[model samples]
Target chain A: MGSLLQIAVRNVVRNVRRTAITLAALLLGVGVMVSIRGTLNGLQRSMKESMVLAQTGAVQVHKKGYLKNVLSSPLHLDMEVGDALVKRILAVPHVTAVAPRILFGGMVNLGDQTLFMATLALDPKREFEVCPKRRDLFDARAKAFGTSADGMVITVELAKGLGAKLTEPAALLAPDKDGALSGENATILGTMQLTSPGERKIGIVPLPLAQHLLKMEGRATELAIAVDDLENAPLVAAALERALGPEFEVHTWDNVATFFKDILFRQDFLLSLIATVFLVLMLLGVANTMLMSVLDRTREIGTMMALGVRRSRIVTLFLVEAAVIGVFGGCLGGLLGSIVVAWLHVRGIEVTMPTSAVPFVIQPFVDVLYIVKIVCLSGIGALVFAVYPAWRASRLRPVQALAGG
Target chain B: MALVELVGITKSYELGRTVVHALNGVDLQVERGEFTVVMGPSGSGKTTLLNIIGCLDRATAGTFRFDGEELGDRDFNDLAEIRNRKIGFIFQSFNLIPVLNVTENIEFPCLIRGDPKKALRERVRQVAEEVGLGKFLAHKPDELSGGQRQRVAIARALVTQPQVVLADEPTANLDSGTSEQIIDLMLELNAKENVTFLFSTHDPRVMAHARRVVHIADGRLVDGTDSGRAEVAAVAGMGAR
Candidate 1:
């Protein structure tokens, strides 16, 4: 250590009780901040992954005018599904899987009760390659899934609300592209869970059955493409648009899910507020401790002043001491936080999200970049707080201080 | 010219609307290499005079000169520079930094002056040996006795090779034996190095070691008529001036 740093160390070591108290405050503040940030990051990651895996996949492909009138479920805007188009999209780099879907809205009747529901028809083999089917997610009979020619799947919440059972008959009433009311009969296969409680009002069936019911043969509303790395979804979407031609439009999950974006915005705002509060509190703690130390050392400071030491050197001395405390305490807190986050990463935290239709589990993630940022923040806060006290010490008159006034 | 000359110096302070005059038109002078003592009772402004002489405090109105340079309007920074390069101070309580060892405390002034590192170590060692603290260089202030601590203070004062060393009651806290020993050591340094010494005290034993005695009472210098020889001569010189 340099002479000044050595002097600061010795002084800090001489007052063990004060040093310990200051260190404790800094340690707890930094540790809690790091852990909280890690947990929030984990929650955000789990929510985004859930939405992508269960609904939008990484990107969605649709006809040029399909999304504008999608709420009306206009069958005239549906794209004709040819094997060549599917093959061309599948050939795009990073395009892991592509599943064709036809979406429609209608009423589901279980004898005494009739409920409005949005419906999705998918190809069993291709859908399984992209997203987990209801049969794969739960225990059901072998024939309950995979192109039974007349099977349907509904959310568990929807089944309970309608008082329906598996292998039972249900009726769906919807409109065809020609403005005719059409009805179809299906047997309930099984039920599954979804992230959004609002999505409970949905049912699923095979693509061919939906085509037959709507009288729009060999047509699909949109194609949901899965990418091996979801982070590269935009690039793949761009490539898919070029390969599938300008007749189609591409939409990433971020554009399709406004709810997730809103939730993320709120989460980030709350976390930032928490971080600011912690930083301010820690800064005050450091400032208070240093001010008291200066009070106790008034005579000693006067002696230095009388010895011809400059005022700036005195201020630098105190600042260096505070920075030392910050570094030591920050490292200790970071280690403790990392240990906790590591434990959560393995054991996982089970969270009951009321907005989710099912139980949500999140394993808290530890971001190295976030940890580094907090450490820097803590160190800088400590220095900033020391400024006032150090300046106060430097301005003391040697005559008054030496006389014990 | 005298090494120190203070003429008509006055200092006052406001304490809650009441003005307290600490120094009142005090005139004094001391030639180079003089071992002088300012003797006074309690609250006689001995400390205030010493503070002004040390450049740690400024006079409210007066013409004060050191080495024939007028210091009446010098700023605090210039006064600090003058103290660093020309004068050394020894407080009555032996104000050594508690955290630093004896050698570090002795070399502290040099460090503030930004002296060369290698030569500063040798000078510090020489001073430590000169003060008979060669073996206690690594000992902190608390580990040493009262007299030993005072010796460390003296070494620190002399380390900068100052032209004058001002001590405020250098023996006020010591017993009779230690006080005599400290006085003897200071006398030896004064004679060997030809360094001027100015100290304040009420003790007769302390005054006995001084070549000239300047008496102070009620913030002004009084004639030392009671003493003979050196005192009467110094008082007569002031009277003539």
Candidate 2:
């Protein structure tokens, strides 16, 4: 076995030019796999990071009916209790930042087009420090989402449908259970470019204005909690659930940021699909290469057999050769894949989304493990592809082979 | 004891709709330290008989005892061990592995046997020197001439110190001069090492080296003669002069 290994290594090296072609194919497969995995993972990472860093934060702490009903009625408790909860949260090591949010459900109507919208109230002074990009959305949503203390910002699609621009007041209507129409003058302050179909029909205002307009006194719909470790979210949610009881539900960013999560899921599915495709192609390539190598070495193997090398040994030799190719190709693919993935990490891949309705283009942010995945995947693919050719090479008879070749 | 004995050996191969008789009831014996050369036209089963004698192929029906061991298709590994440890083969085209250097090619069978490195290196060196392949140790088969490659094949055949070396049309690919030179080398090796050499050939130069000759036609032995023994003795006389 040891002697066989030595022979296999020398043969591989001596046939460097031929072996290099297989290596190149392997490396190419790895590069594509690594780069793609990295980019998709990076995109997911960025969205998650941005979501946590921004005011929407990690875990969205809300009342039980917050999502299901959305009636602008979140049971508000004492600020002292909220502060104590915040302190309790801060006591846990991984807790990062916490933000309060007020939500009001209403209809935004222009001449005849009326669209149901969520009127979220935010403290822009603190929100900007976390979200960091209010100015960009200021023009798109007009008064819908912005840096000012007065007026409101609406999503671009909502504003356009309403025929409302900057400084134009969009009608805000909230109807009580008794069907009493309550209207408020929401002057345009800024606009937010929505990332999804749901968020696109949104309007934003000052927390105080949103409270007053919705006639909800000193009440917040949810408390958004951010954590230092994204992986620690479930622990944090359980802790929050323990701290807050059945009256409230703690939701992780993965659960609350439905749009972002879906996008990440779609990204994952795409990567998996592409990976499956490349692996199949790589398998075919490796099988083809091994078969060709077997054909090339047939006569040589026959001579070895004639010289007293066993048929079993002949098979083993060919198998060992294919394994050598697989291992080398796999390792090369991994190294090249890792390097490419690392490069992509440092210099990100940018894609711009359509600018009319939705405005934030997708950006990918990658890390290290994605690179490791590509290399391992390539190695596995190569090994899987080597089986048949090795078997064929071992099946040859020395006499006929010598005679034929 | 006879070095090789085959009794009533018959071999048939399936050819689509019929059986082709490659060897039929062949009875022969070759003594130790003898050089036996077989000759026939193509399809006359010369190579098949050589393969059977070398234990590369099993007889379809019959008995063969090489150095007192019965030859039958029993275990593939045992047959391989027999081929590797006791017998060496030389091909007409000098079937040296294309990728192996001359030294490595020579060392192949021993390497397969997993001989110790020091011992293998010494054996490879000695054989290369014996075949005048000392300078071509690093050369691949393609890099060597037809004559040089044949030398490497001869060196490979003897490297393991096998008692019997089988050469099948050993000079088919070489020129007349090269063929004569190769025959002389095999004859010299046979005399010096006292190794039994068996050859399948139609080449006259090859026939010149044989101490015994077996002629086969249509898968049957036509003549077994010793005209070669006298020639071998005459060559030895000239060498003495």
Give the native contact fraction of candidate 2: 0.73
Error of 1 at A281 (Å): 2.2
User: What DockQ does every candidate get?
Assistant: 0.49, 0.58
Segments in model 1 whose C-alpha atoms lie over 4 Å from true places: A65-77, A133-143, A164-167, A197-199, A241-246, B224-241
lDDT of 1 by residue, A1-405 (tens): 255667887887778898888888878888888888889988888877777877778899998887788777767778888898888989999998888889998777786777888898888788766765333343354336665887887776678878855556788778876778898887777776666545667888888888888887888988988899889999998998888888889988887777778889999999889979987887788899889889988888888888887788888888888888777778778888888888888998888677654556799977888888787777778888999999998888888878764
What are the per-residue Cα lDDT tens digits for candidate 2 across B126-189? Answer: 8899889888899988898999999998998898888789999988999999988888898888
TM-score quality measure for candidate 2: 0.87
Q: RMSD, each candidate, Å?
A: 3.7, 3.9
DockQ of the two-chain complex in candidate 2: 0.58
For model 2, give the TM-score of chain B.
0.92
Name the candidate that leads on lDDT. 1
- lDDT agreement with native, every candidate: 0.82, 0.72
- Against the correct fold, how does model 1 do in TM-score? 0.92
